[model samples]
Target: MTARVLLLGGTGDALAIARTLGPQHVYSLAGLGRVPADLACVVRVGGFGGAEGLARFLADEAVSLVFDATHPYAARISANAARACLAAQVPYWALRRAPWRAQAGDDWRMVSGWAGVVEAIAPFARPLFTLGREPLEHLNEVPEQQHWTVRCLEAHPGHARARIIDARGPFTAEGERALFTESRIDVVVSKNSGGAATEAKLAVARGMGLPVVMMQRPPLPDAQREFTSAQEVIGALDDYIKRSSNA
Candidate 1:
């Protein structure tokens, strides 16, 4: 039988890895919500309950390997994955995109957390905010903004009432600039998700003299190995699987 790999994936790179894995191994997403209709294999939506729950799940599924390709900000879930895999004595790998560096002319304001952004910058300008939409409690704290533009990869959950621009990216600097210009956005608030895909807002903010409240990514625990690109991730996964299976 093929090796059973529990892929904790929810980002762009995860999509690519899923494509690469194809039908060879049993695949699953330790995801945040209900399972997707188009997914290829099992999807363990939300958490594994916790480390104990996840450890039990891994044992029951007989998952041979674990790959965590979650968004860098999902540190808690990442930790849970690592812990569960460790309890099972299964090899695990972490693949993440590095954060973008602050550059010249960028009027970037850093915050410790995403909720901090919603708090600090909400009073400043009609902010463009939309990375995750679940914890929207902060938006209520600043209801007086001239406008609040939000975009999402998934359909609007009927949970927001802001200026909507439903789309996904690697957002383009040029398009983002146009968006800011059209909306007259004077400030931005976003999570430090890293990668060029989501960093367009930073470039646009720099060019436009607007300010940004950037929430810092949470600290990641030390890993057996960490990789930046897909190729390295693939090699590391293959090696870890070999060692784990043989052991």
Candidate 2:
């Protein structure tokens, strides 16, 4: 029988880790969303209700190991998973993606979180909020009735007079520059979603000599963790298995 693992999932790392442990370890994705392609093992959806619930599940399911592979922003789930794993005496591991870094000429105005962006952009003249549709209103809905250029995956009509840029990303540096230039953006607001998907905006802002109001990433629980790319995760799992066998 294959060794079973409780995978607290949601995000690229979880999917990658699941794919890496295929056939050898049973994976259970515990997020309230559709499972991504990299995760094909036996999956569970939604929250297990914090620590106690997860502890019960671990005991009932006979999970031998636990891996917190959720998004870095998922602080509660990471913490709950750690607590449950510790309570159940299961070995725990984490797969964390590295944070994004600022590049040259990146006119970055870093803030701590969404609230920080709200405070920063609320007063800025000619602000552009690319922090997604859900968060667009948080800053745009201020009493001043400010106008904003909101870029997102779909047409987001949530905010007041938002100049919507309906586009997806994997966007190149040049494309981002063009978007910002055409829009005549003065200040760019965004979340620190540490990935290439939406990071182009920072580069574009830099190229245009515009400063970006950047939100910080969420904190996560510390564990015996392995941080790497999608491909590297597979190698790490294989090495872990080999070492365990040798021991």
Best by TM-score: 1
Tens-digit per-residue lDDT, 85-156, candidate 2? 889987778877777788888877788876677677665656777665555555446545566677765565
**TM-score for each model:** 0.84, 0.78
Global lDDT of each model? 0.72, 0.70
Q: What TM value does model 1 have?
A: 0.84
How far does residue 191 in candidate 1 sit from its true spot (Å)?
A: 1.2
* Pairs with steric clashes in candidate 1: 31-46
**True-structure lDDT of candidate 2:** 0.70
Best of the candidates, lDDT: 1
Clashing pairs for model 2 are none
